[model samples]
Target: MKIKKILVDSLQEAIDITKSTYGDKATIMSTKIVKAKKWLFFSTNKLEVTIGIADSEDFQKEFSKEKELYSEIENIKSTLKDVVEVVKSTKQEQKTPPPITQVQPQNNEDFSLRAMNLATKLINAGVDQDIARKILEDSCGFDITIGRLDLKYEDDYQSLIEGLSKNISLKAINFSKNILSILALVGPTGVGKTTTIAKLAYMYKSQGFRTGVITLDSYRTGAVQQLQSYVSLLEMPLRVADTPTRLRECVGELSSLDIIFIDTAGRSQYDSVRLKELKHYLENVPSLEIALTVSTTTDERIILDSARRFSELGISSIIFTKLDETLYPGCVLNACIKANLPVSFLTFGQKVPNDIELANYENLANILLRGLS
Candidate 1:
């Protein structure tokens, strides 16, 4: 395998460069948008391409790819429009949800009836056609039938279930009483972990829960202070712990509180020692739920790796932030679902509380719709 570098201005040019270099052998190893210089970085076994308008000659003697880069800009614009159009078409098809009833097996009376019922419910729920077909197909072979009825649609059946089922899931969660459970926010730095925690604390507090904020983020200066500011703004108490023993003590002190949210200092998931240390502390807080916070704007591989690493910490759910910054949120959904973790909330804006939404089937569907659109 050889590594090459091609500097370009847009995603399309990056793709083109990859195709030009490796043809059918190329695979997208990773990608990221460098915010400071505003460039797209595409990495592969074959090459690492920096596509930007920035004047840096890692690519050329002038350190500038092109001062007259508008030509590339025009090419990018045209390509982006096409990409958007394709996504729009896909979303439209997803909306229609192709019919699967005609394909149902007719010979098995009992099985067919049950399958039809499931199919009908899925169709009504606005599940996409392909998902419904797979559900129907996969479930037909099961021996005991009634249990299958109650189980929520499996992944293969998801796209086929009726929209009503999703809405029901959403409504059920919305109307369900707020359980007094601890939310432990764990993830890397600058991923909006603090802001996301503030949102959840505010949400529960507004609903009249005796919510308390605890931070084991003593390593970062102003960490406790920042949380304290939000704590004051929310009119809640914020406790700081300098070590795992201290964090355990903090949890013990908050034993009387209805809900105790523990915010650990952000560290890369791959930072084994720190992650294990944090996990060690949480292990002492029996019955506490770890809510992994991930920035939606991150590369998909990073999200997957982070989730995998934190799984050792026993993450119960996911909370994604920076949703507003990403044009497509499919990656967030994909990461969570792949990790087999339920999404708890999505933070779209920088606002303290207003930007967060409790994740449910419908909320996810809606977000997916918006992204594909």
Candidate 2:
């Protein structure tokens, strides 16, 4: 077996380097925290991971061997059991009294049940329990008096949507008015920021706006080349910004264009150094607008944290990406409400220009109340 140790600032970075270096057969042997050079005037803890892999083809081939039908069936059964367990756990969570603050009358059983049911739906859709309860109390709270209930629209889909959307802040970008605008997208890794940037660039280019894209994702393998491919197909200008100086030059070169899109490297939300580095790079660009691209598939708490930190970098609006990958799309509402920022766009798929749209906050509420529309 061949063993190697990798030292990186974050565990995710170590795992990524391992996967790209040794592929599937690599086995992580051990991990430990190590003191790293001081950063941001303080010492940051870094992780050192030790990994091992079989050195011989014969040993490696053992893993590549196909499983028997019996083994496959057993694996399928195990997976199905896991899914059932998850469903049961979720249902149990739904039944429990939520830990959210209650503002309405506690004595009214009927009112409490109705409010709890609505809050449960939001929770199932990945909305934070506290925010969901607030929505129930503030927007959807219906009184069941001795004779009449004012919430006749409770059964209506449109009303539910309007209620949830009203609880959060939403902003729509006017692409036509973004003429001569330079926008930058920053987010965590694997959130489809690059593809979304390409989609926006193409959409504007097709609309007869001279749209251009500049990528600062120089560290990722083939990042520049991928965006360059789209630039060639669209016959639009593409620039690579490796330094703040180069970024300024790229902006000047594309200054006459109707829209300029800056594509930034995806960094872990915990990696504050790189986030600061991103800010230092873009702070010079004139009238620059920053958008945070986040994924609905991400854990709700992580989405909240990501939004908070990225918002520190002056992200005016958010773009929720990979909407098609998650059933619980409430991350949009959760981030917007918690971070107190407006969502500007939504990308559902990998298709260029077609999969992205101006974000619909009501659609989020609609999906939470009912299924996808």
Candidate 3:
């Protein structure tokens, strides 16, 4: 098997290039729009498409084996590097003599320095300053014994960091007694709510559940069509409801289905009139779980504000999208912690059923510490 990343001006060009290079048998792995630097002060946008092809059965087996071995080796290397860093730090600390002080240096200056360093690390990772400070205060004690910033307190510092990273809340979907569940997604424009709904529909359908999708996003151009593309491919039913009455009717019709997902038009969080209209549609719906979808690549302030304003719609959980577009994952933790909501799902790329995952606490913590790059 062979893989190649092709850059082109448009999706059509990418498709043509892949077909010309690898023939019809090639599989498109992912597609993303990125800015390419054409000059020092200017940049142009281009489409990046990763495509793969399998030459033969033997080659596929060889490729799979080599990929697995390479992944294992990389994991081993990362673990060894971390171990080496800890060993080196310990050795350096032993070699240097501790500064002599009558009272063991449990002063405000030492505590302030340590807190500032931790806050700086968090802020550099895209976390809000207030959120970072709150995390530090919540995770570490203010006792004099905890004020030392030396080798003797190295383990304590490490534990404090780990505890702070675990502050994110994670929630899982609950399938009701009759095997019928209703989930609605709401968010701002271009945050991938439609695509995420498609992904969730595909995931549930693949699990042998009778799934149905309904969209109330008829206002957005091509929104229904985008979702229809996926539903049509999966042979699932899709209903477009433009009003509360239509939505209720659609829900009634899909009652026999095991799982039903509702997609809504993206509205600005500041648009209270439209938000109230949306609430009217969902307020009476029984057992409906609303998930507020937000992009991880967005600014931390916007994320927090979106979470706050969307809470008016009674958002039950958060669904973070576009994780693959950003290197800093700390915004996810910051948003969730600030909103006091649990994360339900994470969408990383454009692939249906492939890029979405159930939120895992430890996996997200690792990503926050070591970015996707």
Candidate 4:
């Protein structure tokens, strides 16, 4: 083993010098670029070039005066050669040893590149790459292949959904064709229970389903008022229930209506006692279907936990909200898988009736595939 440092104006010049001096027998051990000049080290058959300061007379003067620097470099080369010789001799002495041919991960850039490619796979499989990467890195302490992303679709509209579906059996309350004249929305806080009810009301009224808006969210200031604002626009009747008994009475009175939209207050899954109380209130409302309202952008773990908690309250189906906030929409997939819940609808934006989608499979599949591409 030999170490030769060649100073040249360019990498090409350095390569030429290396080839001319040692032909194909030389290899570059290491190379660096500094300023305008090139510094190259050649070993067996590979050439490593470093560009050094070309225009700086000071660099040249320092190089010439620094005898200790040259000595240090030489010493390093000598030590490396000795080590190599010792390793070879030791290996030869061994009668039989397992061959070690490891694939070397070169640098940080190489690692990140591998991770990015893995990220692409997760995205392709319907997992959001950014979130997946963060989750993988955080939980596993290493980036892993995005594995087994499932797509979910709702079958309520008789429209084929093209994503993964979980078999978590929520007694789905089907209201697609106005079969039931009255319907109620219920769920924990900010689950878009209000907006989803509004969308349903608009759809029912547009189709001449004789829709009415009912609210059990009057306890929260402005909650009832918000429903009123929309009801006023549609010229629809609005009923407010401060207690479950009132909700039961309202349901019976509204039985004659073609379709009733019930909006409930949002609550957290962790608030088990309050949530149970809320559930108990709606328990006697026999004619209403309690659909679980979920947000698409929340953490996947939280979504699963929420669904598990809500499962006790008898969620018929899920209405996923805020689809526009997440980059990779795989959280929906995770939710469905964990809760064994079917999707009924997805809300992409805050737009009233316009932004809501009926969780159709084909359309979602195409969108998810396009994102992967």
Please list the Cα RMSD from the true structure of every candidate, rounded to 1 decimal place: 37.2, 40.2, 39.5, 22.4
lDDT of 4 by residue, 1-373 (tens): 4456765556677877767776655655557654543447533333346323233465456657687788999999999999999999997966554332222323324234444444454465456544444322322222223322211112211111211221222233455443544555656578688888888789768877778877877778898888888888888888998888887787777777777888878888899898888888877766566677888777777777888888887876777888776565666655765577777777887888777777755444444434423
How many pairs collide in each candidate, listed in order? 15, 0, 0, 33
What Cα-based lDDT does every candidate model obtain? 0.67, 0.78, 0.79, 0.63
Error of 3 at 233 (Å): 1.6
TM-score of each: 0.55, 0.65, 0.62, 0.55
Q: Per-residue lDDT for 245 in model 2?
A: 94
Could you tell me which 10 consecutive residues in candidate 4 have the lowest summed lDDT? 151-160
What is the Å distance of residue 67 in model 3 from its true position? Answer: 91
lDDT tens per residue, model 1, 16-76: 7777765644545555544234336844332336433322334354324454486689899
Q: Report residue 236 deviation for candidate 1 (angstroms).
A: 1.1
Residue 189 in model 1: shift from native, Å? 1.6
Scored by lDDT, model 1 comes in at 0.67
Which segments of model 3 are wrong by more than 4 Å? 1-121, 133-166
Single out the weakest 10-residue window by summed lDDT for candidate 1. 167-176
lDDT of 3: 0.79
